[model samples]
Target: MILENEIGLSSFRNERQKASISILYTYGFLANCYEQFYKMHGMTNQQYNALRILRDQYPKPVSTSFLREKMLDKMSDASRLVSRLSAKGLVVVTQNPTDKRLVNILISETGHQLISDIDSDLYKLDDLMNGITEEEAVQLTSLLYKVRNSLKSTYDNTVTEEQVHA
Candidate 1:
């Protein structure tokens, strides 16, 4: 809705600007869904993402830097988020034995159980995509990848050209 208001998408739709507008609109919608999903657990989106990452890393310790790298948004403060999870007793943090300067993180038993309890609620989020069939989802994914790859190539070309000009 915000994208619709700000982007004035109706005019450019079905034209040259459609791809970019569609990407922006889709992101806005997905972000709203993310907000609603996290709200059910009284957690922020980043916090939920951190918890899920930790769950996937269960039985193995993860580093703050490693988490930052894996996060969907690179701007997130992984160290601070990990600290908050530790404070909530949902994660345990300790100094790495081999490298005192680095910290190791593990999902606490509480965190494991919490994720398990919320599994159903998380799946309920799939309803947001119910209008699309499985085949459509796959096609959407392929088109998205194509768009991303094209963008990446364009960016790389620009960077290389700039460097050459410099």
Candidate 2:
């Protein structure tokens, strides 16, 4: 389906506007797919993301701040996620021995089991990109990186200007 038709818009202001809208729309579509996939496993995408990070770093506890830095969703409250996972017995949280102000988090056996279960069906999630070839996927990734780099400079300039004005 055409993007304009899908969005119910006759046209965009220009190619740039169309591209931006397309990216956002595509992201929403993909996010919805991911949400459904994770929900089937009784977890939210953020929770799964945190678990995956913990799994990768298994046996070595990590801080909530580390999870926040590594999470795909910057808006997620890592501490809250850790608390929720703790409540579900999916993770273990403990006060840092050296730094009482900080807490260490590790995936529990239940968490590891859940992750393994999800991994068995992980190919379904990867299939979401079946519309694109491997080469196109690589190209798309590169393009997104370029876009982020450009946006980073723009964001930095805006923040600098705001600070200066303040």
lDDT comparing candidate 1 with the true structure: 0.84
Candidate 1 pairs with clashing backbones:
none
Candidate 1 residue 92 Cα shift, in angstroms, is 0.5
Q: Write out the backbone clash pairs for model 2.
A: none
- Model 2: weakest 10-residue lDDT segment is 1-10
Which predicted model would earn the best lDDT?
Answer: 2
lDDT of 1 at 105: 93
Against the reference, the lDDT scores of all candidates come to 0.84, 0.96
Which stretches of candidate 2 lie above 4 Å from their native place? none
Q: How close is candidate 2 to the true structure, as a TM-score?
A: 0.95
Error of 1 at 11 (Å): 3.4
